[model samples]
Target: MRPPGGFPIVCHCLLLETPRGLCLVDTGFGIGEAAFGALPGYYRPLIRPVLSDAEAAHAQVTALGYDPRDVRDIVVTHLDADHAGGLRDFPWARVHLHAREHAAATRPATSADKGRYRAKQWAHGVDWMTYDDRGGETLFGLSAIRPLCGLPDLALVPLAGHSRGHSGVAVDTGSGWLLHAGDAYWFHGEVASPPHCPRTLALTQRMIATDHRERLENLARLRELPAEVRVFSAHDPRELDLAVS
Candidate 1:
C-alpha cells in the first residue's frame, strides 16, 4: 500500500540472535535482482522495490560482525516473492513455514498462488521445516505453534488471510514478547482501538488477500492483544522506526 508523500514501502525483516544460531524471521528482497527475476513484468511498476545489495540479509549479517553462515534457520511468514527472496542467501538454513503455504507455493493450484510464489527463491532446494494448524497452543486467543523446531523462545502464530498459510513469528525477547505480524496489516493504525486503515491500503490488502473475510477476522484478534505484547507489521515504517528507536 502506497503511503502519502510517496514514502517508500519498507520490507522489515527480523534478525534474532538465538542459542542454536542466528535466526531470520523473514528475508526481504535478496541480493541484487534475484528476488525480482521471477516476478512478472507488471510487478515492477506496482511494487517498485528499491533494490540494494548492501541491504541484503547476507550483507547486513556480515556488517554486524557475524558470518552469514551462522544464520542456521529461517522462519518465513509466507512464500511471497519479497518475503522468501533471501532464502537463497542462506541456503544452508532450515526454512520453517506453514505446510499449506508450502503446497500453495510449490504446487501452486491457483493463478494467484503462481503469481505470488517464486520458485527461484528456493531453487537451491532448502531444508524445509513445515508445520500445520493441528494440535497447538494459543497465544492471546490466537492459535500458536510453539517451540518452533525445538527453539523454545520462538513460536508461529497462524494468521492466515494474506496467503494460504501466512503466520506471525512471535519472539520472546526476555524483556517482553514481540510479534512480527507479517502483512497482516500494513498501517500502524490497523491495530488501534478503533482500527483505521487508508482506503487505498485497504483496497490493496483486499486485492492481495486469498481470503478477505479470514484476514479481517485475524486482524480483529490482533487488535485485542494485550498491551504487554508488542505487535508490528512487515511494511509499516512507523513501527520499524519505533522498533529501532
Candidate 2:
C-alpha cells in the first residue's frame, strides 16, 4: 500500500518487554552504513536498503531506556539479510529460527540461496537456537511453537513459503494476540479477503518466494485469522505504524 507521500515501506521490528529480558522479533537493516555493497550487485538496486544510526536496534533499545546488552534473545522469522542485519549488534543474544532456515542460511546450496543471505552480518558468532519440532500448540488456526523457551506469551507460527522456514511471531500483547507475519506476505492486501496487491509489489513477492504456491496458501489462511488476533507484515508501513501507536 502506498502512503500519502510515496511507496516507502516500513522496516518494522518488534521489541518485546518481557520479564526475563528483551526479545526482538526480526532486526531491521541494523545500524551503520548501508550494506547494499555487500548485496549481490544485481539485487542492490532492487533492495535499496537504507540504514540509519538511530534505526539500529541497539540505539532504539537505548532510547527505550534499557541497556542494549539486556536484549538476550532474538526470535527470527527468517535469516534474510534485511531481517537479520541487526544480529551483529546483539552478539550476546540467543538467535532463534526455524531449523530449515538455519540450514539454508548456513549452508546455501544454490546460487540463488547464497545470494539471498549475507554472511557478513552473522560473522559475530551468535548463540543460535534452531527449532525442528513438528508439533506445538495451535493459535489462530496455525500450529505454533509451544513454550517458546522463556517467553510464555509468545509463540512461533511456522509460515514457511517465502523462505524455507519463514515464520510469524505471535504475541499475547495483553490487549489481544498480535501476529507479526514476517515476509509471509509483504503487502496487507495479500491477505485481504479478496487477496489483492499492487502488480509490481505482487510480482516482487512471487519472484522472491521460495515456494510460490505454498506462500499463496499461507496467505489465504492468514486472512482467516480471527478479528481479535491482530496480524501485520514486516513491510506494511500503515499496519506497522498503527500497531506502534
Best-fitting candidate, measured by TM-score?
Answer: 1
Q: Which candidate is the best by lDDT?
A: 1
> Which residues of candidate 2, in runs, are more than 4 Å off?
1-6, 35-37
RMSD list, candidates in order: 1.7, 2.5
Q: Please give, for residues 46-85, the per-residue lDDT of candidate 2 as tens digits.
A: 5555567787788998998999888999999999877888
In terms of TM-score, how similar is model 2 to the real structure? 0.93
Candidate 2, after superposition: displacement of residue 119 in Å?
A: 1.4
Clashing pairs in 1: none
Give lDDT for model 2. 0.83
Each model's C-alpha lDDT?
0.87, 0.83
Residue 34 accuracy (lDDT) in model 1: 37
Tens-place lDDT per residue, model 1, 117-154, is 88988998999999987778988777899888857899
Give the range where candidate 1 is weakest over 10 consecutive residues by summed lDDT.
1-10
Candidate 2 Cα deviation (angstroms), residue 95: 0.7
In angstroms, the error of model 2 at 43 is 4.1
